[model samples]
Target: MFDVQHLSYQAGRKPLLRDVSLQARPGELLAIVGANGAGKSTLLRLLSGDVAPSDGLVQFDGQPLASIPAAMLARRRAVLTQQHTLSLAFRVQELVLMGRYPYFRGQPSAHDYAVVADALATVGLSALAERSYPTLSGGEQQRAQLARVLAQVWEAELGFLLLDEPLTGLDLNHQHHTLDVARALVQRGFGVVAVLHDLNLAAQYADQVLVLRQGAVVASGVPAAVLTAAHIEHAFDIAVELLPHPSLDCPLIVPRPRAGVGAAFSL
Candidate 1:
């Protein structure tokens, strides 16, 4: 299990996260939702050990995150950030193969190759394996990056995948597909904590939801409890109506125009 206790972060005298505590268990998906600049990504960085907390603790399977060796941490957890830039040209397959670097060092074995192929197939990028990374479209690139992370912890006994705004460039079909892939990982006993903007997707797929506002946790619980109309309105500062999903029992959020506002006016 991944556990965080009173986690907080500060940036040059400014607080970015405050007294945040949450737990992500294996075989479950924890979705973090909030408005832009709510510190959702900051919290993900803390959990992934990309940044140290200003106060409190983060532990994976009872081991302090700070105490874990970099190579061992790489094997146990993988992170897919919102943006990636590559100055050097590399093929998609080569980028995915990089995930196996911690295990294989400079040389890759047959198993590493097999894992890369499987990851490419999992992200629906098998046909683009030989293509250059920069040649792919934004969404395709995002998918390829996900495949890389997938290959990283594919064989770990206890793994955690931290995704920050993973659906950024994905289209509708790929958006659902990506979340479905994350759900599939949960079934295999891998913990996933995704920073998501779409509340409906979180409702449909998450076992637990954490809502943040102004760098603080406003709510945390099952989707049905944390995604209430009041919570949505408060967190996003927008009026919305909650309705049941046509097929699923989860809540569907439909943004409503503010009172006395013209249709032409943007919310």
Candidate 2:
């Protein structure tokens, strides 16, 4: 449902992303993983059309991202970035209700209210709907932001969902549950591309993985193919031991021994 071809992003003289090409399909969850400064966030921004690519095109359903009108794009695509801060003294329900802005001009209709309520309930925020946004903790706020996106783009069919580092600040249970929500969306035929810091979570949740190193795609494929121990060491410069999970039906990654602690190995 979403395609990026030869995508590149330049900031001044430095290129943040270089020739990053990939595709996201309906009923699939794609995770982009890389170390800090590897341009994961930049790639997400480019894919979401929040920032235009300095080179090539980001296409959604065969249409150039730049050609889409703002209102039309918002009605189809939804983005939840890492930086979410609001100083306004609005209630949580009121905040989540903002997601319906794309559907309603300014005033929300009954359908919009129903969407907002559903979004709040989806994120387990129904009880906190009347609370102030500022009073919630960081994790709660993050979930609230997701609820807003859910409410905003619920009417959107055949669209892209870009979530940049959505797991940050979330507890373990919330993190897993957040991915559960995303996976449910994919099951319902939404194309999802997320920037994930936790490789374990990515391996467990993503249908495919895209590994970025130094602004370029170093590897991209199924988790079992793209998340090998060598690739993890090469991309992140950290040694990890790859082994099958004891009970779970997936590969698990664990930190390898330190330099002086065990035998050395080459990548």
Candidate 3:
């Protein structure tokens, strides 16, 4: 599990994140929701040890994150960013196999191949194993990236996954499918801290929600506890109805127009 305490960061004279703190419980799905420039990505980078906090502490399983070695950290936590671009053209299978580099040091074994195969299967990419990554569709590319991250933490007893805008650039079906894969990963005892732009998607999949505005947490708790009509309205500057999802037993958000606005009555 990941625990952040009194986290704060600054970019030159400007503050990016201030007084941010939260804990991701083991096997729970925690979604971080905020508008642009709200420091969500900064938070993720700090947690993943890609960037150190200017002021505060990040702990992984009781030890400070900085205390963990880089190689060992990769074995414990996996991260997938929003902008995953591959400059070098590689086959889908090859890109995924790269995840085992920490263990195999560029020379894969039979066990590494087994792990990569399982990772591909987890993301439903086995059929496209031999496909070239650059020629694949955007959705397929995203799934390939998912497969890489899956292989990174594959059966390594990982504690958490740090994902930023993981549902970007996908159609509705793939969005749902990708989130389902994330959910299944969390169910298998991986804590997840995902920064998501889509509040409804967060509401549907996240066990807990953290709403940040202007680089601070406005609310943090279970989805129902944090995702209220007024909270959404305040955090997002839009009016929405928080309804009960018929099957998921979670809150669903339905956007409604503000007063004096109509579809046919435009100024």
Highest lDDT among the candidates is held by which one? 1
For all the candidates, what are their Cα RMSDs to the real structure? 1.8, 3.6, 2.0
- Candidate 2 lDDT at 165 equals 90
TM-score of each: 0.97, 0.95, 0.94
Worst 10 residues of 1 by lDDT: 258-267
What tens digits encode model 1's per-residue C-alpha lDDT throughout 1-267? 888999989999999999999999999999999999999999999998889999999998899999999999999899999889899889999999988988986689999999999999999999999999999999999999999999999998879899999998999999999999999999999999999999999999999999999899989999999999899988999988999799998988999976666756766
The top-ranked prediction according to TM-score is 1
lDDT of 3 at 194: 92
**Residue range 148-250, candidate 3, lDDT tens digits:** 8888888767557788888877889888888888888788888889999888888899998999988899899998889998888888888898777888878
Full ranking by TM-score: 1, 2, 3
Q: Residue 226 in model 3: shift from native, Å?
A: 0.1
Residues 201-265, candidate 2: write the lDDT tens digits: 99999999999998999899999999999999989998999899887766899987666644455
Error of 1 at 254 (Å): 1.0
Better of 1 and 2 by lDDT: 1
